[model samples]
Target: MSILKKHPERDPGTAEAVGGEELLVTGGHTFKTLTDKVSGIVEQKPPAQWWLIFVMAVSGMLLLVGVIGWLAWEGTGIWGLNNPVGWGWAIVNFVFWVGIGHAGTLISAILFLLRQQWRTAINRFAEAMTIFAVITALVFPGIHVGRIWLAYYMFPIPNQMLIWPNFRSPLLWDIFAVGTYFTVSTLFWYVGLIPDLATLRDRATNVRKKVLGFFALGWRGGNRQWQHYEKAYLMLAGLATPLVLSVHSVVATDFATSLVPGWHTTIFPPYFVAGAVFSGFGMVMTLALIARKIYGLEDIITVNHLEKMNKIILVTGSMVGYAYMTEFFIAWYSQNEFEVFAFVNRAFGPYAWAYWIMFLCNVITPQIFWFKKLRRSIPVMFVASIFVNIGMWFERFVITVTSLSRDYLPSSWDYFSPSIWDILTFVGSFGLFFTFFLLFLRFLPMVALSEVKGVLPEADPHFYHQKEGDTK
Candidate 1:
């Protein structure tokens, strides 16, 4: 019988039972359903709906290629870099994409440590988003240097000239931080994927089985195999939890260590970290809803799961707002002329429109989640999540452009406007990120099948009596 029909007296919209015991794997999912639903995405042929999205993603990617080609031919001069505004859209884009990448690690690591069961539904999807977003973010700093060919010079190597990158630079710290983040995140994601891959291996035919078997690492599902796997996964989770904080803190250093008025704030580390989580969760919610609809995994990725995610979004969005207010408060409290001017200029200056947009979207928008009805409404949540994403991108732009466009010297001050190439490059990054995401959706198990199964009621060894209806 359907869980819904079985509990006819239960709340119509809820997946829970009469006694209010929450359902984890809903839709009357047996172990077979859990395995089949997840692995089936990979084993089945591509759907017509999936191909439509794939074509669109590829078109965007092609635009990215064309933009990069033009950028390479004409050089950085084609961008909007000028006397005072050197960072322009490149740094803005870099920070925006980096911020979007943070939620995955946070969900996968921190929530796991807290034993949040809801995370199992979304962590795989979020982790994949992180890797793709980081890849898109990496493209900016390399090309922003104007000499893409000399990008290798950022690394420490024994060249004949022996010119090492500036060891003291915060940008150098960014390289270490982001590099380590990507590396550890990949390891963590892959480790989590192994058991799911083993599930795929067991269920597959000849060719598919062989391919998945290789990556499955010869798992026999023995007690020893699980013992080792659990230990390794726990260790990776521990290592990654700290990285979720450290990576963005280092990115903030790229601006905070600078002497620029708005950029030199001491609160940037925590501020950037909060903003990162806020933006990252926004992207996750956006994609999670779409994935839920398209894949018909509504029962597995339930409304309650989404509600929990929105709560996190609300908290982090508020943290970001606190950072914004604190920035203004410190500016006034410090009694520093340039600092005061910077905050004043950000609100009422040339880029005031963007600042207000950021404020409204980041601050005023997410406040809707305060109501339970709005939190459960998918349509409302979808619009709100997109607003948060847009707001975050603007936040980066407002910080990077407004701060640099009007610096200490009035003579060198000029407005920053992105040229055609700059605009296209930024748009192209969305193509790069979504193309990988679409392909991942088509090919991989979107949910962690093994993890989901592990959480099912039957998986408990001590639950044999419950199944037998013995209340001893």
Candidate 2:
């Protein structure tokens, strides 16, 4: 019998029932009549749906192959880059992707330390997003080097040239920042994945499961495994918190340390960090919202979870707003003529339209969260998350182009425009992000099944349902 039927005399939707008592919610509805709705949203699909994801994965791989083929065939000229604007779209894409990468670590590591219980439901996907986004971002810099073969030059070693990369250089800092963050984030994610993978392994009855099982590292969720997992998890959380901040801060240095007018501000560290989390959370919100709807995981991703993330959007978003203000203030205060011009130019520059669009998306749209009703409303949050992501892309653009277009001299100023290839590659990157995510959803349990089911009080089978009759 359903929980509602057991307590037919009690009212529904109360605080103690939802929060304190922590019980599964079963409305006065039967599974027979709701089969279509439940199956459409929840309860794994037939074999056909999985095949669609497999097709998408293959297509995504072809796109990468095509991009590499084109990049190799045309050389660097296919991209939009000139003497002054040499960095162009590739670096912009890199920075944007890295910013998007921060969301996972912030959500999983920082929130975990704060002891936010709601995180247990969503952290797995958020961490996965971080790892994938980093993988995507790392590709750009390597390919941007063009040779694609000698890309290893970015590293320093004991042999060969005996010369080291400039440690003081911002670009070198990027290598450390991105490399360390990716390594740490990957470990954190895989560790958390071990037990769940073991769960899937146990549930599997075929050779495919056997292959995936080997990667499960022989996890059994025994007392020993749990103890080691807990300590390792906590240590990783500690290592990652500072690493997350440092990675993006150093990424900001790629622009901040530069003497260029718009990019030279000291505020880039915090500003970039805020923008990263803002975008990362936006992407997380985008994925999480869809995962809940399409997979019927509402029990795990409650409205409260949505509400809390929206609040985070509001908070980090406000920090980004303050950073924007500080950048303009510092520019004017510095009394540097070029610096002053950069700020003025961005507001009324050729890219001013893009600039304001970013402002509306990043600064204005998230303010809706201040209202209780809007935050809990899924539709509202989904649209807002999309806007935040758009605004973040523009933030990178305003930084890259505004500075590149104009510097110390007017004659050197040039308008940077992306060629057709630039646009295609950008779109293709989205395809790549989504395709991998779709595979992640179809396989490996999108909502972290073992983790989510664990959170329900019924999982205990004791406290929440005492002596059968007492639960009523």
Candidate 3:
């Protein structure tokens, strides 16, 4: 017999039988137990720890709201943008949060298509993370336009102005790409939650049942409901697959379409997509670790799951590093003076410290995953993930700020710095992000309860048939 036998469990989304009874979900649970265990979280009184996290998150959100109101009132003067450096921390944060949103789609859509069973345990939470990250990302662009009221002009409105947005510009492509991605992703997430919501409704108190049932869409576990649910889920997964690639690609075009020395590279689309997955995975790791500890979800979100995500981080990090090298190689090979200056300036210019930090965090830190022992270590993985997040943010900083600060015009070049409002607004987005995340954890089922139940051996009829010695 092989050291690892085929896992007797069956998962609805996974076609292949995985080996090793290493247990994707711990605690021997029947379907009833699984539903109760997950839903009981919402039914129970809030933990002291939960309140502490919620308070901090809400405070940050209040700060974000206050800052946005002030930004609207005071106008763009509160930021550090100037003549040459029109693009500053706002653009950087926008791209940073957008990149951080990619991992959830990758796990929820791409992994599902690939038939990865482990995804069932954490896909719900990951999807929530994606939605919140995108929400944070949308703010920067809205505020960056200076006239917050006029921000709606980016969309095609049948108004008397009759002046449509410049469709030819890649920047405009962002509105379509991100808007579509968010819409589809939200639909996918809500669809997945229906069955679980039904489970919650069945196990809830009278008032709570009404709330859960409203969202549950009258789910009754009938054969027809499961059939339709499966079809809808697969369709959404197929629809979302391309978005994991397209959304960030459109974002990259915003820079690539520009003729700026550092920004004009053709590699931006694929490179940005890779970096997005890298940074998004980093955010997932950061949240997964904290949530697991707080909710005692170590069984559902196992060390193996963490290791798998770490591997993706390492792969995507290497891809980003290669993009960095390719940029330099292209610069040197082309022998273009301005391009060379931009590349060299990025490494050794006034912003060299930021560039080096990006290199260390996005490249060097993730290399720690090459060691299996450290990859599986919670503390090591958590710290490395944090570094990746910081590094990826600085990666955007280096790309956006460094390039614009010292452009082709020698006289107009100037260093970009953030104002107090800029700093506060950026920090406040975190509050908005976590405030939603905490509420999600508190109210919604953090794990996909139905999907997880499907992963158990008892769920597989064939496994029981084999036990009865019935070959057919």
The 10 consecutive residues of candidate 3 with the worst lDDT sum are 11-20
For model 2, the superposed segments whose C-alpha errors exceed 4 Å read: 1-61, 158-162, 458-472
For each candidate, the alpha-carbon lDDT, in order, equals: 0.88, 0.78, 0.90
**Alpha-carbon TM-score of each model against the true structure:** 0.95, 0.87, 0.95
Find the 10 residues in a row with the least total lDDT in model 1. 1-10
* lDDT per residue (tens digit) for residues 1-472 in model 2: 6543553322223213333554332332222222333323323553565466557766765677688679977788998888678888788789888888898999889988887767877888898898889888988888898888778888887657787777889888888889999999989988887776776666566885786699788887787878888899899999999999999899888988888889877788888898899999999999888777756667667787888899999999988888888888888889988899998999888889888988899889999999999999988999999999999999888888888888888889889889888877776677677677666665664444445445444345443455245555
Order of all candidates by lDDT, from best down to worst? 3, 1, 2
The count of residue-pair clashes in candidate 2 stands at: 0
The local lDDT score (0 to 100) that residue 470 gets in candidate 3 is 56
Better of 1 and 3 by lDDT: 3
Per-residue lDDT of 113 in model 1: 94
lDDT of 3 by residue, 1-472 (tens): 3212554544433332333355677655667767777887887886899999899989999999999999899899999888889998889999999899899999999999999989998799999999999989999899888889999988988768878788998878998998888888899999999988988888877888898889998999998889988999999999999977999999999999999999999999999999999999999999999988987788788899999999999999999999999999999999999999999999999999999999999999999999999999999999999999999999999999889999999999998888999899988999999999989888999999999989876676665555444565
Comparing 2 and 3 on TM-score, the stronger one? 3
